[model samples]
Target: MLIWLFLAMNFIITEVVKGIKHLYNEEVAESLISIQDTRKEFEGQATIVVFPIVRFSKKSPEQTANDLGAYLVDNLKEVTAFNVVKGFLNLSIANDYWLDLFNNSLLQPDFGVIPSNGRKVMVEYSSPNTNKPLHLGHVRNNLLGYSVSELLKADGAEVYKVNLVNDRGIHICKSMLAWQKWGNGETPESSGLKGDHLVGKYYVIFDKEYKKEIEALKAEGQTEDEAKKNAPLIKAAQAMLLAWEAGDEAVIDLWKTMNGWVYEGFAISYKNLGVDFDKFYYESNTYLLGKDTVEEGLAKGVFFKKEDGSVWIDLTADGLDQKLVLRADGTSVYITQDLGTAQMKYDDFKMNESIYVVGNEQDYHFKVLFLILDKLGKSWAKGLYHLSYGMVDLPSGKMKSREGTVVDADDLIAEMVATAKQKTEALGKVDHFSEEERETLYYNIGMGALKYFLLKVEPKKRLLFDPAESIDFQGNTGPFIQYTHARIKSLLLKADYTPGVFIDNQVALSETELDMIILLAKYPSEISAAAKTFSPASLANYIYEVAKMFNKFYHEIPPIVKEEDEQLKRLRLSLSDVTAGILKSGMRILGIEVPERM
Candidate 1:
């Protein structure tokens, strides 16, 4: 609001100056105004750069700034004082203005949520394969996707969260084949393992045996390529895939059984992670959908058929090589299915934008997918975006799924919860809590720590995840923010202030109090910036700053309940209450929960 006020003051100043010296139009004057927050050492609320308009005033930057500042203070009641720092015109706003904004902000229920902008956004994340359990990488994907979705919704977009399960293809067949040959009728019930873990075990087994077979063939003097291509295990998996595509009942039944187990496993993990989807897309259902689109492209000269009858799109003009859409056998490739799925999603949601929350490794894949769709003359192709994020590594090294070296999502979550319990107990603060309450508190802290750690980094930057470090109660971590929130809640509870109690504006404010209010005032702007960049990291860090500032204020300022002046005590309590509310709302945007007690 101060920024907008500065803009209005600048406009009025320009209009009045026009009567004296008409050197520039209103548009040019508007462009010349650069308003920003005043630096901490400066005694002002906002500063406007005066150098950009000095030519129009025919004076030195400092002189022009002083002139403009004096004019503003004379005309505007809100402008209390002004200072000229070189080309910067810093204006201190009246305390009543800030108090009024703070009071009004408390009255609005949806304080930070923007009004709906009449746009729909579809986010696709957690595109898992049935051959494996959700791993650490998938954890990042799901968290980022879900957080971005919530972030957009906070900025007033109708968001649709969807998951496209990679439940079919050769990789899935490998798991099925391994189970058929070596499982000996083992099920999740028999092995006491989750369904996805069970399936992932067979997938690893298939890879191990396949590698052994290839080594044997190499020992017989065959080339590596020959061994890999002619391996009996791989051939069997390929045959199983063909059988699956041919609609063989036995293969279908097996596919359904194994995928059912995976689905159940995924559901448990998703629920624990606090992520959800409004719709689910399966590769089995959507794989063949793009063939029609490919055919249409062929007719429209967007694609060409080779001698083997495989359909291809020439993208060299777009700085990429030719891409395969359909094989000679009339089977759709990954991109083919993606093309159809993109169209299908648009038909379903009529969204203005579609974001795919995928890893950076698939950057080229998405580039080709979007280019093909665009060349095919689809009007909505421009809205397709690949939210390409970097991979998350552990301190040990990168995780490999086929070798079973990946950190399982469920296991990591359980470890976080256990770590939370251990740390919370060591703190010795929750001894008075009931067993159930303790359990819930541990869960909230654990999940909150995990989600915040993953989301606090920029989406495009690679990160190293250290579980031990993440659960710490200090630094830029989730538990720290949660603890700050809990501290504020405790203060408010002890003060026994009634909700919606209006504080008199006559009381003098401390520097800390005004600083906290200023930070609180920027919450809506933070949300808008986070939404624009599709980065929850912005909000994550913003909330952390708020929490940190509140903590500092709590330590430096007088105790709320011990204060003698009732009005000052109420004002401090009001600040604590509003800070807690903002922490809760900001954490919610990141899909992290802040507990009332830590």
Candidate 2:
């Protein structure tokens, strides 16, 4: 989202700088001039801090503000009146300015959206492993990555959304091996289970049986770590990984079949969750990518090979320990695949920035990855970022995929929709909706509840998600903002509002009405801030505030739809119209949908 600021704030700041130059014969940077919303106790729509300008004025603070106030009201038509309080200058903007914004803002389809700024970026998110279905942890990851991409687009950056599926390695081989050993052929159709869930079931089975082997070995007097290393199941899974990589036909066929099932399962889960990817890079295809690069790094002395033949990079002087890039057995590690994948993505898109939306668990991993790339003299390494977010905790506690205790993404989506159905029916508004309409409404409300709840929090914070608490129709929840959008739509429908209708400047205004226009003006800035921080929570909270303000304006005035004066009624209707536009545009980028009714 782009926060191309409104005219008044920019205009005021520019004029204030000019005023300072003329009055004090001084040079001032525009950034030093602070313009903000007026305090409730003050008598203006906007407030300017006079203290920053005091050094330019030879007079006392109050006197300096008074002189500036006189200059502004006399010279600028937008400044209708002004008052001085201590060192602050409160300027009441003329109604013409407010009325013009309400009138013209609706003319453009993309009201607060900024045009393209020619910056190309790639956001990698929802990078799931084929060994298991996505879980609550994946939920937060997907929502954050998708929304951040949308936010960057709104800020006028050309963005590509990509996903990296961990389809190879020992983890996947474990699931494949367990399925083969335990099952007499259990396909997704045969078991009536989602493909990913079916595979995930075998993964848990592998862990359970693997644990038994470890415990039995431990009982034979070996240490715990020694038992783990000697476990037969682990060795078999490792062998399977080697075979699959070596292109053994039987292992390769099984890998393809199982990975296919998981992909089918992942598609349904992603659609239900309202997230997607433009391109997918599998670890299997890119696992060998960084080998040549490693050789190049070795020749350049960026990498060192120890006596055992493992390639490594020394970074202790850079405040980090040495990191291994390749094993002595000539196999790539996890970071090796990442190093190659990063290079391939850059080679494909050549984006200005490549943001990795992974959990904080990989913070050190990315720091090393980017630093290694930089040491290898890749120019794009400078633009690499790790958008590290904290984990999402449930009331039950942290989830474990190997224990089969994680909440499946598909199941959670169904539960949210079901919860939405129950709450919406209890609320009694959806009784008139059709079966299909009711289902669609339920999904929108439910997913809106889920996405908004996850996106509204600062991405770096570990959030405890309460599904029931998030579905409420009031408070700062998703349903509240969704409902507010519906309310504005209902109001616009009743008033028969037409876009681009002229709003008279002479109409009498209430503080709440003007307060809404002022609040609406902040939408552009909100987008800019959200994009800069790579945090959807900033935009999420701003929309909630706008919704709250709209509701206050709605309830405070009785029958705005049927006021005695035509001009006042039209202005209110237009205000409602613009509010609805802002709410819809804001929520859309967060991967949420707001219904026109209910």
Candidate 3:
């Protein structure tokens, strides 16, 4: 619509330049046109800057603005009036235009969703290892990835959500070896522990024992590195990795059993997190995938072999150090697996874009991976993106998985829900609800608060998760927004809102009312900007502002149910209805559920 107005203004200005001014230079006329949103102090809807055209008119900025403003007012029905401020020609849109925009938006079921643009995008997130239960870090990863995928979908791109499980490697072997050596047939069912937690316990146990052995070896006069390498437990875990790689049935069976437990645990956590993936890729299946790709790269001379038979890619030319693609023993390294996975993903979806939602620690890793693929002449490599996000910390400081100090995702979620229940009960807001309804509401608010708190921050910045701060009902928090939605819903219900009632054009709108209409009109553009930047923070903050504006309007404007005039009541009710719709729509994109009753 803004573009349409710009085109309309351009045509009118071009005509004015050719006929009224007798200056037919197309370049001068084109350069003179600039349309933008009116400044807050300006009494208009849109502003046309006339400073650029003053030279063409050989007139003062104010006079040139006045001339252009007169032409626009006479030509465009939407431009009912205009004012000149210095060089800015501020045009006031007629009240009917705002009403029509509201009505058009109300008629459309999916107001902010863009039409399909025929592009496929693959977003890989929640790349959790099978060694342990997901922690707060994984929570951030999943939320960011899921929200990004939804943003892309809202932008009309075909998106595929994927997860890559690190089910192989020495990390998995640590847990398996620990269980084999220490366990007397303990399982999740027997221990009454979550599967991932149960497996994680063994991993921690392995670390503790490995440290003890290393200390003992050091006490026996060996150097630190020698002690670490000679530690019996570490060596056993290393052997287990080799055995599993060699397809040893016993090692493979143990690996599957333990990984199965972790998978089951992960499934529950993902469900609780309200995140899902269309597919899952396993390192066990993909570890050898890149070996063939390496051979191909070597054949193409994209990678060179050293005397020790190790294949390397000299990315120094690309401003990165030379990276090892394959070891001297002909074993595939991390980059090898990544190369194979990239090709496999491309082969699977042929996505126009493939986004890896990884921690910033792996920024260099992705740079090398993408460069290697690009050097291999893969066309889709250019579309690969590393959505590197900063780590999530707690007020308690950093977490260490080996030390068993990380805040587990399941536990954090449970705590959040509990916190919600406590906060809601303290406020005495759920006195009339049943236990089931209360539980559902608590879940929605808890998860909503959790997700919104994480997503409101820019992805590249490290965040401190403060549970109490996030669940507040009176600030820039999720519950505050959720409460506003509930408030609007309650107001609408009390008024018995009836759809399709036309607001009278003669009706006067208060400043707050007009401001809200303008804000509501910006929703589609906000979503587009959010999608384009791959940042939910934009939409999150926009919705917060909308909620804030609505709250102010609720306090300042006349009560909708008590408005004396029928037209006024209908208009106020329409405003409330549209505000609620946009609030719900925006929160949905952030993977939040706005409850009908808080």
TM-score of each: 0.96, 0.96, 0.94
RMSD of 3: 2.8
Judging by TM-score, tell me the better candidate of 2 and 3: 2
- Candidate 2, residue 31: how far the Cα is off, in Å: 1.6
Q: What C-alpha RMSD separates each model from the true structure?
A: 2.3, 2.0, 2.8
Model 3 misses residue 558 by how many Å? 1.9
TM-score of 2: 0.96
lDDT of 2 by residue, 1-598 (tens): 2222556468888888888888888889988877788888889888888897788887899998998898899889999999999998999998888877766664356679788999999999999999888898999999999999999999999999999888988889999999999967999999999999899889989999999999999999999999999999999999998898789999999999999999999999998888889899987888888888788889999999999999999999999999999889877887887888898999999999999999999999999999999999999999899999999887778876655567778888888889989989998987778889889999999999889898999999999876667666568888998899998888788887787667777987799998888788778778888899999998999999999999899889989777889988888887888888889999999999899998
Displacement of residue 216 (Cα, Å) in model 2 is 1.1
Q: Candidate 2 local accuracy as lDDT?
A: 0.88
Q: Sort by TM-score, best first: what order?
A: 2, 1, 3
Candidate 1 residues 65-176, lDDT tens each?
Answer: 7777777788777788999998888888788877776777753566676899988999999999999899889999999999999999999999999999988999999999
Considering only N, C-alpha and C atoms within 3 Å, which residue pairs clash in candidate 1?
none
Better of 1 and 3 by lDDT: 1
What is candidate 2's CA lDDT for residue 234?
99
Model 3 poorest ten-residue lDDT run: 1-10
Candidate 3 residue spans exceeding 4 A from truth? 1-34, 50-60
Worst 10 residues of 1 by lDDT: 1-10
**Candidate 1 segments whose C-alpha is farther than 4 A from its true place:** 1-27
Each prediction's Cα lDDT score? 0.87, 0.88, 0.86
